[model samples]
Target: MNIHSVAPKRPDLDRLLIDSALALFAERTYEGTQMPAVAQHAGVGVGSIYRYFPSKEALGNAAFRYAKRTLLDTLAEALADGGPAGTAREEFARFWRGFTRYASAHPDAFVFLEHQQHDTFLDPESRALADELHRVAADFIERGQHAGAIRDGDAEQLVGLALGAFTGLVKLARPAGGLDALPAEDLDRAEAAVWDLLHRKADR
Candidate 1:
């Protein structure tokens, strides 16, 4: 997506800080990654970090937003390239498979995203960014529903349920072997079950 070109003109102090924090947090849990360390890694003064993020929690939320945006951008590109068609279940599974590959290639970023999902005190702007990521998925869901590819139900609810199931599986497998815990074949099997749940009836 040409991050440098698309990003704001102002100094990317916040983004750099968040990227540094994510690297540290992946190596050591979030509790172990301190602000000073993040600042050092970002090559920014500690005061610069505080000027952008008042607290560690705020920094974590910013990292979460960055991770979500990265993932969503990947999904958008995959969909644009005609990755999948027909059903919401099919499309989402395609997007997710691509996402898993990206996550596997960048394990730390994946872990950071997982950590953020459990964090409740994220800043308002960070939460808004997270919500926007979902909006991308929700748009696909809504389109599938309109095309009679998805079952009749609340679009938001379906998206939530699908996301919950997929992430829950990842969370469970992560303990077994981190990002590589579940192989692509295994994930494909799991995706089949999730797809069955969301697919429209034949009579439709």
Candidate 2:
């Protein structure tokens, strides 16, 4: 008769809270989401959320890290499967597909991460995760440049440009049921167009 042991484990509850928070963050901006709302979404008492996250800012940071990590992992898996032997063009295609997969499966996370403002409360670890993604992408762009496959530019800027195109495409598709709603041909066209933005041109 150990009712305490039967209760959701701490890690399970933590994930439940974070998932609930992300869902609300997507619907209402992070600034607008309230603790009670998160508790309601998680199907737990308001006190339970506070038990795991000391403050709303703590929950927000956790949600940001979760969403960002999901994105990074998706990209990593795609690149890993393609392997080092692949050409930059091939790798780029894998990277594009990785983004599509992430966006399709976690559209709410994408909206939460992109639609909310994060200037005020992100902590060091959360900030580092954000920077890590930028650095990893810049490394890829630099390698492509060295191979004469990608255009010569500030690698960070190039990453921003490529992802900016992705962000725009996802936004465009969100109303129609997110990235998955787009036809395969449309996705391919968008992917090719984004590559054209980063790829080297003879005149350039």
What TM-score goes with each of the models? 0.70, 0.91
- Clashing pairs for predicted structure model 1, backbone only: none
lDDT of candidate model 2 versus the reference: 0.89
Output the worst ten-in-a-row residue range by lDDT, candidate 1. 112-121
Question: Best candidate, lDDT-wise?
Answer: 2
Superpose all Cα atoms of candidate 2 onto the true structure and report the RMSD in Å to 1 decimal: 2.7
Candidate 2, 3-101: lDDT as tens digits: 675666446899999989988888888889899999999999999988889999999999999999999999999888835736888988888988889
Q: What is the C-alpha lDDT profile of model 1 across 1-204, one tens digit per residue?
A: 655756558977777787788899877877788889998889888999999999988888777777777887777776766644655666766777767666666667877776444455577787787788778777877888898888888878987787777767767776687557777788778878877777788983
Candidate that would win on TM-score: 2
Off by over 4 Å in 2: 1-11
Candidate 1 Cα outliers beyond 4 Å, as residue runs: 1-17, 23-54, 83-90, 114-121, 179-181
Report the Cα lDDT for residue 79, model 1.
70
lDDT of each: 0.76, 0.89
